[model samples]
Target: MAGKVQKIKDWKGSEQKGTLKLQEAEVPRAALTDAISEDILCDLAELFKVFGDSTRIKILYDLFSGEKNVTEICRDLEMNQSAVSHQLKILRTAKLVQGRREGKSIVYALADEHVKMIIAMGIEHTEE
Candidate 1:
């Protein structure tokens, strides 16, 4: 059977001027079958959402160098302890940051090299 051609329409419920015909093309079934699962796609989207907030990005940037207590983070970022802690909680839940008890305070740092690479790539992209 011949491929189907679709009419390109415009907003006024009429055929557009100088309209181009769109033909259905054969898709690779293997590519579709090998695509990531919907659950994994949703999880990846959620992870990117965690990086969407400026406050969280600032917190991650601060933790890039070394582990820091909440007080030190607040002092460096000039943010309040409560605000910094709140952002940290979200970061921890996303597994982007990890914290360990240091004496009376909890020191926080990036969870792994993946986080650093992601941030570094983002910075490089923006610079370019």
Candidate 2:
């Protein structure tokens, strides 16, 4: 039952001769469906999927410093131009990063604060 307390076995080495003590715990329920819609969930899943790529993560981390052209990104990451551009395209489609024309190159950067915050949170969580 949602939000109901129930007694369950502790599974620790506290068992008695012929009986076991039960611990009171709350059973988890689906809490997200009430707060998020299916479409939003799908979009969130897609957003995370985009983050699943290592190349994209590197590009985002590079952008965290400041805007840089694809050539700069390629040099910083030691990757080729086309590979970096492809990852940038995915990041752009996910709205995690953006680019602008500077001279003859497109200088890329994180789209907004939320992106930087997301990556920062991920770093913090991993360290924890």
Candidate 3:
């Protein structure tokens, strides 16, 4: 498969670490030095932490195409209800999955464009 795909590598704290907007600033070089507050890295690390689990990855994979209830995910992935539920709880807390009450069941879907794009880019990387 060959096509256009958006890709973002894990931030490799290079010399050019911050975004380009900061890079283009007309301020002095010393002022241009990125003095990152410790919390910024911590928050970014937490973002990756959400993607660091196999179970969570599977939950995202199962729902990649569209929303699905617990039963649908369990049945499609051949997982037990407890197993799917546990993974889903983690995804929900990460804000990676959104749940809505639909009759007796809740449907879960990817929470944002960024999550979907990252997953798509990951797929593309492996495919490449």
Candidate 4:
């Protein structure tokens, strides 16, 4: 049933009698497939995957403030050079951030204003 409410049981104990609880029971919402476009779903999955990693999240946070070279980012995070470089590469590939060569180093920053907003929104959501 698409909208039929039901309850199963909790891990702690058996199901309480006479309680019609809508638990994790898989009640398929037929409208969901219609509600979300494929493109939107793909984009959301990509965004979540990008944000899933602690290293990438930190990299985004570092770039959120302003442009910084790999060395600067490494120092701030107290991470190794190669580790920071790897995360930066992933962020760049995702187009969440971009970098330009400055002297001997490539300075990275948020590719678009949306990036900062995305990070801010994430922080706000998780903090709450």
Candidate 5:
């Protein structure tokens, strides 16, 4: 198993001492330090949690095409306004989507290019 770490365990199911193997190339020290902060790690976890909901994922996929209001999302997803709005609030809080006032309605869109890239990469990974 290239690039895999193997932890040797004893009969009691406890990890053995000094049997850890890093069989592949070592990870860069800079890469290790860059992601070590607890706050950043927790934030990343929270962001992924936001993506765990099917409703939120559909809303994000809908927004990928362009900005749409609550009504449009509900119609497109065949859901009620309340449910769509609730998921939209979650998406907005996670900074995955943004809304702006247009006349009397609020049009929602992907927060930025990073969000599009994230969704695109996710789709690509799942398709494979």
Candidate 6:
């Protein structure tokens, strides 16, 4: 099988053992220019950074079921109120979640359908 494999000119193998090779490709300058702007790229990076935390992921998973207040989230996830609030602050800043005043407490939920889609896709990928 190794002998039957074909190699491309733009891909080069690394000298180190058990490491993957790097592949280079040329894309049109027009396409590159029309691609995401630097500011948007930075914002996207910031959004993904929020998703990188396991605690935040748990909070998000619970929120997926329905909206819940900080106290409820803490109780359901077995996390402390302060810790949940801190994570909620980060999630809110990233626009992944939003909260609304409900009587004496604020109920939080996914910010938009995009948040649900992101979480759904992540779960699908992991299951596969």
Model 4 stretches with alpha carbons more than 4 Å out: 1-36
Pairs that clash in candidate 4: none
* lDDT of each residue in 1-128, candidate 3, tens digit only: 12233232431112331211111112344433558678977976887888888777878876766789999998888889999999888888878899999999999998875575566556656778
| Clashes, model 4 | 0
* Rank by TM-score (best first): 2, 1, 5, 6, 4, 3
Residue pairs in candidate 3 whose N, alpha carbon or C atoms collide under 3 angstroms: none
Candidate 2 worst ten-residue window by lDDT:
11-20
Q: Clash number for model 5?
A: 0
- Tens-digit lDDT string for candidate 4 (1-128): 53554443221112442222222334244533348889988998987898899998888776655789999999988999999999888889899889999988899988885665566556656779
Task: Give the Cα lDDT of each candidate.
Answer: 0.76, 0.75, 0.70, 0.72, 0.74, 0.76
Per residue, candidate 1 scores C-alpha lDDT tens digits across 20-104 of 2323334445534667989989999999999999999988877766789999999989999899999999999999999999898
Q: Model 5, range 63-115, lDDT digits (tens) per residue?
A: 76678999999999999999999999999999999999999999999898567
The positional error of residue 103 in candidate 3, measured at the CA in angstroms, is: 1.0
Candidate 2 at residue 30, lDDT? 46
Report residue 103 deviation for candidate 4 (angstroms). Answer: 1.7
Poorest stretch of ten by lDDT in candidate 3:
17-26
Could you tell me every candidate's TM-score relative to the true structure? 0.72, 0.72, 0.67, 0.69, 0.72, 0.71
Better of 1 and 4 by lDDT: 1
lDDT by residue for model 6 (1-128), tens = 45344443242223542232335445455544567889989988888889999999989878766789999999998999999999999999888899999999999998875665566556656879
Which 10 consecutive residues of model 4 have the lowest summed lDDT? 10-19
Of the candidates numbered 3 and 6, which has the greater TM-score value? 6
